[model samples]
Target: MVSAAYRRVNGGHDLAESNIVIYTHPTCEICVTVKMELDEQGKAYEEIDLAEFPERWSEVEELADGDRITPVTVENGEVTIGYHGIGCMFYD
Candidate 1:
């Protein structure tokens, strides 16, 4: 069963099952914006803050192919680094 928070955002879909993950940092404006967009779209995602979880920084680095950046979005095995004016690849 999907969690109550996940259900509220994704219409009863389990976010973990979807495998949507976002890598972010606390001071990044782009990260904040991307998070807002995700919330607005009602998409459930797992946000990993590098500041809070330093161990996950390597994961983001690998996903971004060594480019250390914030707001790295991963959805269903697809990785998107950086915000390009719109939302994540799975936004729509």
Candidate 2:
């Protein structure tokens, strides 16, 4: 079972300015951690909980390029899967 979210953004920095969307679920601690980091950074993001919307799993797969990894951070088509992975820099 996999889940995810879609973020539609207008700006690139703040939640009030841009809409950073995170696809996540309550069971996914990684998802929680991702939100925490965003919160700590003072960056705002909208979270799509897959547990509530189960059909969005395909979206996560699509973003993950077929891998069913939750909490994948995507910005400007760049994808960072799992914690501390290369390429994406949502944590940094």
Q: Compared with the true structure, what per-residue lDDT tens digits does model 1 show for residues 1-92?
A: 33332322222333554477777777788877777787777777777767677666677668866666778888788888888943222210
True-structure lDDT of candidate 1: 0.66
Candidate 2 structure quality by residue, lDDT tens digits, 1-92? 11223243322233444346676767777877787777677765666666677666677788877766678775555666766762221210
Top candidate on TM-score is: 1
- For all predicted structures, in order, the TM-scores are 0.72, 0.66
**Regions of candidate 2 where Cα sits further than 4 Å from its true position:** 1-17, 86-92
Best by lDDT: 1
Error of 2 at 50 (Å): 0.6
